[model samples]
Target chain A: MEELKQAILNKGVVVSNGVLKVDTFLNHQIDPILIAQMGQEFVKRFNGKEITKILTIESSGIAPAFTTALELGIPFVFARKKKSLTLSSNLLSAKVHSFTKNETNEITVSKDFILEDDKILIIDDFLANGEAALGLASLVEQANATVVGIGIVIEKSFQPGREKLEQAGYQVESLARLASLENNTVRFLEEVATK
Target chain B: MEELKQAILNKGVVVSNGVLKVDTFLNHQIDPILIAQMGQEFVKRFNGKEITKILTIESSGIAPAFTTALELGIPFVFARKKKSLTLSSNLLSAKVHSFTKNETNEITVSKDFILEDDKILIIDDFLANGEAALGLASLVEQANATVVGIGIVIEKSFQPGREKLEQAGYQVESLARLASLENNTVRFLEEVATK
Candidate 1:
């Protein structure tokens, strides 16, 4: 987590008031070594939980979820952003509002992937508005699966995402929590918490 | 490779003629254990290549690329299907035609991640039309990076992808090379000499 914070500090760019860009390492261009470590950490965080499957959303959540799935030795199921011809017609759908895109889109997962009596672990790169995570949780519920935990690489604490998820009775754990992004400088709550 | 073949024969779905869907394990719902083994196989296949990075496209390609990158302890850069707010303005772009989607979309990788001197190993889930592979290759070329090898989970031999890529002089390795998929039955080519 410290390494991730340092990487964000060194390379992350604040594009606007709320947008923190860590594309140099986090999402677009992935640091696989760090991602693998993050996956291990997630495994540690949810050590006792029965994580039968990892649920993520494309296209950014794929990397971290992939690594996490490998670490946990579980199957990774990601909700496709678009419905391809290869996908089946029976799917569980949820509406996700993207803060960056400034629009809501329908996210879906095939019914065959997630089954009842399965324990799911949801992973993602960032949790901003919590729309995507909530949407994925919606799909897990549709499958009659239990969401064991929610693991995030980076979380925006100033946003209401964490509170919203907590209110929904989901245990959320984020490696890096951004406390504030003011005047083009990103600050971490963990940094202040440690001091 | 035998394990991969067995996984396909046991779990892969045979769609109509020349179409085999291994989405249950390869793409839609990914088996991370098998993917980890495949990653080791990729490292062995491209053993001597100076691979500085693992290159792939978004969505399905991210999983295998993540595994290979973890195996080699390298970074992975994925080309996005569309530009997002987080994406940088300076990018290497290429047009990719998806056979399943029946549409052509432009994929882009930000110039900041890939360097001119980088030696990239490309990885993907399937090699059907090879448009996605070629698109990633184009991004690497635009970055002035060398594509050391192309690792595919499955290759449809009936498709012209391998021929086209080999003509372009790329060292390609597929886990299972299907000789043909006739009447919804998948068959692999006979064991041949390895390059």
Candidate 2:
């Protein structure tokens, strides 16, 4: 987590009060080494319990989720944002609203992927309002699967995402927790706690 | 490569003459161990290329690309299909037409990521009409970077993708080459040749 925190401080761009752009290493442009380390960190954090599969949303969530699944030696399934023609009709879906993009997308996964006895670990790049995470959990529940926990690479602690997931009775583990992005400065939750 | 070919024959679903659904392991629901093996295979295939970075499109392309970048100890960048609010105006953009979806997407990458004198290896999940691969090559060219070659996980040999890329004067390495999908059977090019 130190490397990720350092990367955020060094390469992360604070666009505004609540927006932190980590396109250089996290989302748009990815550092595979760092991503693998974070995936290992997630594996270490969630050392216990059974995880049959790793679930995530499409695009940004695929890399970290993939790496974690690789480390865990499990399969990962990503929920597609748009329903493609190739996708089968047997699907478990949930509507998710993105605060960043300011649009609602119906994310879906094939019902054939998530089985009734499966234990799912949901992973994603960023957690702000918990809409995406909650939506993923809903998909797992629809299939009568067990929700293992939520693993996040970066969490905006100033937001209500963590609290919402905790309220929903899901364990949330975030590698990097942002305390604030005010005045063009990147602040970590641990840094603020030590003060 | 044999494992990949076997996986295709066993799990790959042929929707029609041209459409092969590999959602079971290659795309929708990903097998991480197999993906890591494919990544290592790519490293072996593109050995001594001096690749400084791995380039891929978002979603389906990220897994194999990430694993390849991890094996190569290089960074990987995925082009965003839709421009988000956080993305900057300075970008390297290209228009790619998706034949399956019957839509065109203007994929873009941050200008800060791709640089001059960078040796990039392009990776993707599927190669059909060569639109996505060509669009990716254009992005690298716009940045004045050198494209070492293109690595594809699955290539429809009967399609025009490889021919177009080869005619464009780029070396392409496809892991699994499909000769035909007629009569709902997955036929590999190697199998066809041996017969």
Candidate 3:
């Protein structure tokens, strides 16, 4: 988590008041070593939750989800933002609102992939507004699966995302939780243990 | 390679005349064990190559690329299918035609990621028409980077993708090359072992 916070502090660019751009290493270009470490840490944090599958959204979440699934020795399932022609007809659908893109998109996952008795963990690169996480949780509920926890690499803790998920009765864990980003300087939750 | 081929043969679904869906284990729902094996195989095959980075597209390609990059202890850079506000302003963009969707989309990567002197290995889930691979290759070229090799999980040898990449002067390696699909039965290359 220290390495992630450092990487973020070093490379993360504040686009405006609230946007933190980390394309250099976190999103567009990935540091596999750090990602693997993050995945291992997630496994350690959620070790005994009985996770049967790792779920995430497409595009940015795939890498971290894949790595975490590999570390936990579980299958990884990602919800597709768009329904491709090659995808199966039977699917579990949920409407997710992206505040950045300023639009709502329907995310679909094959009903065959998620089992009713399985326990799933949702992982993603960023958690803001908590709509995406809620949408994923909705899909899990649709499949009659249990959401063990929500793991995030970077979280804007000032936003309503954490509170929303907590209200939904889901346990949330973030590697680096930003308490505030006033004056273009990032601040952590103060509870993070420094290495 | 045998493990991959067997996975395809066992779990892969034949949709139409030309479409083979392995979403059960490869793309939609990922099998972590098989993907790890694939990462090891890619490392073994491209052992001596100076792979500074692993390049791939978003979504499907990210999984294998991350795995292979993990095997090689290198970073992975995935090209985004669309220009997002989260991405940097400066980018290397290419047009890719998706055979599955019958649509052409622009894929972009941040210019800050790939260096001119970097040796990149392109990784992807499938190579059919090869348009996506070539587009990714063009991105490397835009960065003035050298592509040491192209690693593919599955290659439809009957398609033009392999031929096109070879003609473009890339050392393309596919774990399982299907020679043909006769009567809904997949016939892989004779020398290529299916696990």
Per-prediction backbone clash count: 0, 0, 1
Please give, for residues B1-195, the per-residue lDDT of candidate 3 as tens digits.
889878888888777657888889888999988988999989988988888999999888888888898888888999989888666488899999897898989999888888999999999999999999999999999999999999999998889999999998999989998887656777787654332
Write one digit per residue (lDDT tens) for candidate 2, span B1-195: 988987887788889989999999978999999999999999999998899999999889999999999999889999988777778599899999999989999999988889998999999999999999999999999999999999999999999999999999999999999999887888888875221
For A30-134, candidate 1 gives per-residue lDDT tens digits of 888878788888888888887889999987888788888888777999898767777769889899889788878888889998999889999988998899999
For model 3, how does the per-residue alpha-carbon lDDT over A1-195 read when each residue is reduced to its tens digit? Answer: 888889878888777667788877778788888888899889988877889999999988888888899888889899999888887599999999899888889999999988899899999888889999999999999999999999999999888999999999999999998877777877778754222
DockQ of 2: 0.90
Best TM-score among the predictions, by candidate number: 2
Q: Where is model 3 more than 4 Å wrong at Cα?
A: A191-195, B191-195
- Each prediction's whole-model lDDT (CA): 0.86, 0.92, 0.87
- Greater DockQ among 2 and 3 belongs to 2
lDDT for position B173 in model 2: 100
On DockQ, the leading prediction is 2
Colliding residue pairs in candidate 3: B2-B195
lDDT of candidate 2 over A5-32, digit per residue (tens)? 8888888888888888889888888999
TM-scores for all predictions: 0.95, 0.97, 0.96
DockQ list for all candidates: 0.79, 0.90, 0.84
**Chain A TM-scores of all predicted models:** 0.96, 0.97, 0.95
The runs of at least 3 residues in candidate 1 whose Cα sits more than 4 Å from the true structure, single-residue gaps closed, are: A193-195, B191-195
Q: List all candidate RMSDs to the true structure.
A: 2.8, 1.8, 2.2
Residue B71 miss distance in model 1 (angstroms): 1.4
